[model samples]
Target chain A: MAIRYPNGKKYTPPNSEVKKRSIKDYSYSNRGKTLEDEIDEANDFYLQRQIAVIHKKPVPIQIVKVEYPSRSAAVIREAYFRTPSTTDYNGIYEGYHIDFDAKETESKTSFPLKNVHPHQVEHMTVVAKQRGICFLLIRFSSMERYFVVPLEMLQNAWTRMLTGGRKSISLVEFEEQAIEVKPTYSPRIDYLQAVRKMLP
Target chain B: MAIRYPNGKKYTPPNSEVKKRSIKDYSYSNRGKTLEDEIDEANDFYLQRQIAVIHKKPVPIQIVKVEYPSRSAAVIREAYFRTPSTTDYNGIYEGYHIDFDAKETESKTSFPLKNVHPHQVEHMTVVAKQRGICFLLIRFSSMERYFVVPLEMLQNAWTRMLTGGRKSISLVEFEEQAIEVKPTYSPRIDYLQAVRKMLP
Candidate 1:
């Protein structure tokens, strides 16, 4: 299967079957399912068993222009992101409040710091202060690896940013602290299992 | 002060002193804001004070076509509501999860039953079973009155449908059970005050 970016450029998934599969073979050839689609599928699976209740928060958009062509339909002609939102997903899991962001990086060596928005990091920090489970699902597309990095590691990365360090998180550092998640068809990416393992 | 809907439709506020006052009127004016604008303002107000953190869930839309003008922007050309969504707003307040739907009815005598969808009612029933606070914010636009009617009342109304009852909720019943919310500028709907009153 061919991988394509929004730019219409054809790309190759890391550890493709055409090449020798690595220990971190987590890339998907499916073209129809987006990152959000996979996450929602996983959420539905969790909900069915009464395991967790989670949802992706809507992107807050300010509709500048709307065309009501008819009485029943209102079409937004122009809109903009209203504010820097809190995170991608949040809800209750096993009697604990869970908050997280899902991010994809094509870098093979490290995930760029620029991928982590300042406002989102601040929001995750607040979630941590409230004792909520906060983390990020980091997808290394080039390495075909996925890691669940806790909010503490993210905060530490942010602190390093203030000191003018490298603009990316090295894969070596990630392997030491981040928990790896194996992908499956039903739940898509069962990162929660990694989360469960991390939990005391 | 002038009263208006978010889309700039003019109206007289419930108790407006000015014949054409903008800021002089109480809250619930749309002279300068839109429906989405009011919901955003209300959510921010709730979050700031650690009050009831309510938010409008995203409208479930099935996008059939997208017109990508640039790499950073994509315009949805065709979309439709996928399924009947549960409610407009939901969040946590003080320890209880609060869920509700807001609707405006122009009929002074009765609110049309057509406005409430079967799926939303079903979602509310599930929420109720989970011990969540579920209700509806019914606004009699012409009468300038708003009420928070519990799901139980709505379920009773649903049952009455089979017996061939009126297809609308009478104003008398709303006046008896629905808590009237005097809108404010900052918090807009100010539904939490009503929530506090509802709790035992």
Candidate 2:
């Protein structure tokens, strides 16, 4: 099946071979899927099972030229994708206000600060002060390791970087401060169990 | 200044005269602004004052074409706006998980049930079950009345309608069950204060 965009343009899937290979090999099920894709699948699992209702905020777009082909159908001829002003995923989990972004890094030794935007950092800071559950789901893709770093820890690192500190959080520091989330067949990345440990 | 899409196509703003007129009249501040826009501005006010961190999820778009006119600037030539799979606004407020949709109707006596989609109702139901705060910010535009109708109230009406009841919720029913929220200067629709009233 040919994947096409709304405007009838063809959309090429990123990694078709790897996606096919991963489905066949259960051991490497998590290999082909991107961190965001895995998290989305996990959220779907959670929603279907009535466990949680987290969702990734849609990418903001500025629509300019919209053609009404029919009375009910509006076709967008032009639009601009805008940067998100907040974190990606957020929802309720057992009465808790959960807010976080799922990020992936190729670096094995450190998670680069550049991967996160300043606005996101500021947003998370405010959310934390409001007593909401704010954290980062950082996945070191090369090493197949995932960590749930709390807002406070991220703030400390962010503050340090702004004041002439390291641009990245070292793996050593992540091991001590962040909670590791192991992958599962159903939820994919079962970070909520790790989140439970973070609650006061 | 003329508005243009990323594809360099001319863009027309909705309700241009009302928008232009509203900019001049300070007293009729919320005149031209849609309920969603008013809520967005209110959310901004809340965020800036450190009162809450609510946000409307961006409308999802399927991008089909892009034109790179320059090395750094990528222009979206074609896209399609998609119907949201979830509610519009959601966030944390004083340790509460807030989720809702802002809707406007010109009808004076009753608010039509067709304004609320099935997926949104389902989403709200799930969020309510998870113990998160869920409701609807309904505006009777002609009557200049606004109400925060809880998910339970909405559910009751929805169930009745599904079982061949009235297609609309009467003003009497709204007065009995829903919490009236008047428009204000800072947070245009002060629904959070009303939400606080609903909490135990």
User: A79-110, model 2: which lDDT tens digit per residue?
Assistant: 66577889988998988899999777778899
Candidate 2 C-alpha error for residue A118, in Å: 0.8
Query: Which portions of model 2 miss their true places by more than 4 Å?
Result: A1-28, B1-29
TM-score of chain B, candidate 2? 0.84
Model 2, B1-200: lDDT tens per residue? Answer: 23433333234345453545544455655555666667877788889999999998877777777776676655677666677899989998888889998877778899999989999999999998888899999988655689999999999999999999999999999999999987766667777878988885
Interface RMSD of 1: 4.7
Q: Using lDDT as the measure, which candidate wins?
A: 2
The residue-by-residue lDDT of candidate 1 on A55-89, one tens digit each, is 77654444456556766866655544344456767
DockQ, Cα level, model 2? 0.50
Segments of candidate 1 deviating more than 4 angstroms: A1-34, A57-84, A92-97, A125-133, A194-200, B1-39, B58-86, B94-96, B126-132, B162-166, B175-179, B182-188, B197-200
For candidate 2 chain B, the 10 contiguous residues with the lowest summed lDDT are: B1-10
Name the lDDT value of residue A61 in candidate 2: 74
TM-score of chain B of each: 0.77, 0.84
lDDT agreement of model 1 with the native: 0.67
Q: What TM-score would you report for chain A in candidate 1?
A: 0.81
- Summing lDDT over every window of 10 consecutive residues in candidate 1 chain A, give the lowest-scoring window: A1-10
